[model samples]
Target: MTKTRLFHSNANGLIEHDHNRDGIDRRGFLKCMAWAGTGALCLIEGGVLKSFALGTRNASQVQSHEVAGRLTFVQISDSHMGFNKPANPDVIGTLKAAVDKINALPQRPEFILHTGDISHLSSPDEFDTVDQILTATHTPIFFVPGEHDVLNDDGKTFRERYAKNSKGAGWYSFDKNGVHFIGLVNVMNLKAGGLGTLGNEQLEWLRDDVKHLPSSTPIVVFAHIPLWTIYPEWGWGTEDSAQALSYVKRFGSVTVLNGHIHQTMQKVEGNVTFHTAFSTAFVQPAPGKADGPGPMKVPGDQLRSLLGITDVNYVQGRHALALVDASLA
Candidate 1:
C-alpha cells in the first residue's frame, strides 16, 4: 500500500493525517461562486453569531507549514447527506460547502477524519454521494461508523465501503508521524437516539491492539459516540468505553473524539481529553435543551454559522493537544 501523510497548517493551527494510498484530483472541487481575491471567512466575529445558510466564509488568513515535528488536521462528524429538513434542506449542499472550505484553505490537511454518520439512512447512494463530494479535496479522508450508517444490513455495506481493512467488524488503527490513531465502531445497534455500545469482541481486540505500544506514545481514538458520558438520559455516551479506555490509561496522552450528540462539547480527564464534534449536517438540541436528540430547526441564517469542525494538533515531545474549533458559516 502507498503511504501518504496529509497535513494542513495555518497561522492559528495545524492538522496532519498519515493514511493508506489514495489519489485526489481537482474534479472533487465543488464550485459555488467564482472570486478573484482570497477572502478571510470569519469563524467568530466579535462573538456575534452569523447564519450558516449562506455558506462558509472565505478565510483571508491561512498558511501552510513546511515539514514540522508537530501539525494539525480536522474532525468533521455526522454528515447526514440524504436528509432534507428545515434545519437545512440541503445537507449535501452544506457538506459540499465544507469541502470547499477545506479546499480553499491555504494549507491542505494531510487528511480529514470523519467520525461516522456519513449517510442518514445507510443507503448505497447516500454513501456514494458523500464520497463524491468529499473527493473534491486533495486531502485524504478516514472514517468510522455511526448507528445511522449501520442500522439494518449489519453494517455490511459500511464496512465494505470504508472499513474493509479494519479487523473484527470494522475497527482499526494507523500511525502518522508518531501518533497512533484508533477508529472504533460503537453504534451498530443503537437505540432511538440512545447510548452507543462497543461489543466484547471489539473490546478484546482493542486491548491487544495497544498492548505493544509504549505508554509514552500519543494515542487518538475516534468513534461515533461519546466515549465519556455526556448525558445518560439522551443515551449519548458509550456503555463499554470505560473498559476500552482502561487499556490506554497508561499512555501519557490520549484524545477521544465522537459525534452522536451533534454539538460541540469537550472534557479533559487526566491524560484523556474527550471531545464531541459538531455535525456538518445539522445541530441537535444541546443536552436537555429539547425533548430528545434529533434534527434541531434553527433560523436558516444561523444554521451554517453553527455548523463547524474541530482541529487538533499534538505538540512534539509532549502530551498536550491544542484544539481549534472552526464553524462553516
Candidate 2:
C-alpha cells in the first residue's frame, strides 16, 4: 500500500487525520515536527505556509524564513471564474482572496501555477478578469487547461492565449533552478465524470523530455486532473496515467500536482508524491461521499474555510519538496 500523510486545516490549526475517515477534532493541532524531521509538519495560520525550525518543539505558527527551500512556488487551482451560483456567489472574491494569500507570503513565491479551470464557461471576459487580477502579483505565471476551459473550442484559443510554448494538446516543460517542471494537458477528450485523457502524442513527448536528465534531478508535473486514480468510479483519475508515470518512475523524486477535484488529497508511492489541490471558488464532496462531484454549497460563513491554496517548496540538494495546503479562511 502507498503511504500517505494528510493534514487538514481546522479552526485551531492543522489536524492530522485518517485519510480513510474524517474524525477531526476542531481543537486539535498537528503535533509539532522538527524542521529536519522524517516528514513535513505544516502549521496554517493567516494564510502563511511555514515549517517549524530546528530545535523548535511545538509551535502553531512560525516565519517562512524558518523553512529551508531554495525554490518556492504557489499553486492555485480551479478558480472557475464567472461562476456566480449559490454554491459560491462570489467566485471572483474568493479567487482574489487566494491571490492575496500568495502576495502575503512572507517569502513571495518565485512563480505561480494555475492548474486549470481559469474560466467558468470559456468566456473571454472571464479569462480577461482573472488575467487582470493575477497580473497584480507581478510574478511569472504558468497554466494548463481544464475541461471547462476548452468547452467552446478544442483548446485553440487556450493554446494561443496561455500555452504558446506547449506541444501537442497544450503540454509543455521548462526548468527552474535545476528542477524540471512539466505542464500537461489531460483535460482534453475527457471521459465521463471528467476523467482526464493524455493522448499517446503527449506521452511520447514526455518520455523523450526527461530521458537525458540525471535521475537525481527533481521533477514537478502539473495538470488539470489527478494523474493517479482518485475515484475512477467518479471519473476523478486520468485514463492512461500509468503509462505516463512509467516514463518518470526511475527518477529519484517526482511530484505530480493536479486540480480538478477541488480538495486536498495526497499519496506517496515509491518515489512519486501525487497531490490534488483545492479550488479557490468552491468545494466538492469527498470521493464517494456524495452522489456525485460538483459545486458543493455550504454556509456562506464557512466557505473560505473549505477553500485554500497550496504552497510547494523545494530544498535544493536534499531531493526533498514540501507541500502545504492552507485555507483562505
Candidate 3:
C-alpha cells in the first residue's frame, strides 16, 4: 500500500509529522472537518449548468455585469452553529469564512438558500449568532430545518425565529423570476435510524400548491434531507419523498436541493436533478466509508481542499439550471 504523510499543528505553532495512522486525533480531526464545508455558486444559462469555485477567484475581480435573462443564487448548508465537538471546535469561524466568500462574489446572488442544521442544539443563542454572522452577506436567506434544529419542542424555537409564515411544520412555497420554489419539512417525526418523513398533510399541500402552475414553469425544491433515497441505512434519505416528488415530475425543469449528509452528491431522474450540499461546520464520512456517518478527519493540509461551495445560475427561456462547485483550496 502507498504511504501518506500526516501532519498536525502543535501549540507552539510547529508542525508535527506522523506515519500513516488509521484515524486522526481529536484536534486534527476537527480541523479537517472545519475545512470540509463551504458555500456554493451555481448559474443556469442557455439551458446549461455553469459552476465555478468560490475560493479560487478573487471576489473583487468578478465584474458585476448584468446578463440579460439570467438569475443567480447561492446555496449554503449545514452551518451547525453551537457545535463544539472534536470534529469541529470552531463552527462559527468556518461559517463566517463562508459568509466572507459570499460577500466577495462579483455578482451578488439574488438570495441565499440555507438547507438546514443552522444550530446544533436548537438554542436561541446559536440561532442569534447565525443571524448576526449571515448579516454580513446583506442577502435574503431561505431555510428549512435539519434534524438538529428541531431538537426541542418540534422546532418551536426555529419556526418562531426563522419561519413564521411556513405551514404544517414549516413547509412553504414562493415564486421568483418565473421559477416556483418549494420548501418542505421532512425532519419531523423521524424514525430511529430511518429516513426523513413528509406526512400526509404536507403531501396534500404540495399537490394543491402546484396544481395551478403550468408544467413549463421551472421548479426548485429545498429541504434538509435528500428527497430521493440516498442511503436509507444511515437515515440520509427521506421516507415518503416519492409521494412528494410525484407532484413535480410533470414539470419541464425541476431541481431539488438538500443538506444533512455533509457532502456533495448528485443524481438525475427523468426531469428532475437532485443534489446535496456540503456542511459549513464539519465533514462526515462518505456512505459506508466508516462504521456509520459522523465526522471524518483527514490530513491537515488536505482539509480545505475537500470543502467549498456550490453556485447556480438560471437564465430566462432556459429549461435547465447551471451548477458549479468549488473548493476552498
- Tell me each candidate's TM-score: 0.78, 0.84, 0.81
Model 2 vs. true fold: TM: 0.84
lDDT of 2 by residue, 106-163 (tens): 5678999999999999989999999998897889999999988999889998898999
Residues 1-329 of candidate 1 have per-residue lDDT tens digits of: 11111111222211122121111111111010001011112111222211121223323221222112355677788899888978879998789877877776444567889999999999999999999998887678899998889877999999999988998768999998788999999987555665788988999999999999999898999999889887788887788889999999999879898888777665656667676776889988877778887789989888886677766655566544544456677
How far residue 49's Cα lies from its native spot in candidate 1, in Å, is 26
Which is better, 2 or 3, measured by lDDT? 2
Stretches off by above 4 angstroms in model 3 are 1-69
* Candidate 2 C-alpha error for residue 254, in Å: 0.6
In angstroms, give how far residue 313 of model 1 lies from its true place: 2.0
Q: What is the lDDT of residue 121 in candidate 3?
A: 87
lDDT of 2 at 110: 93
Off by over 4 Å in 1: 1-69, 189-194
Please give the ranking of all candidate structures by TM-score, highest first, separated by commas: 2, 3, 1
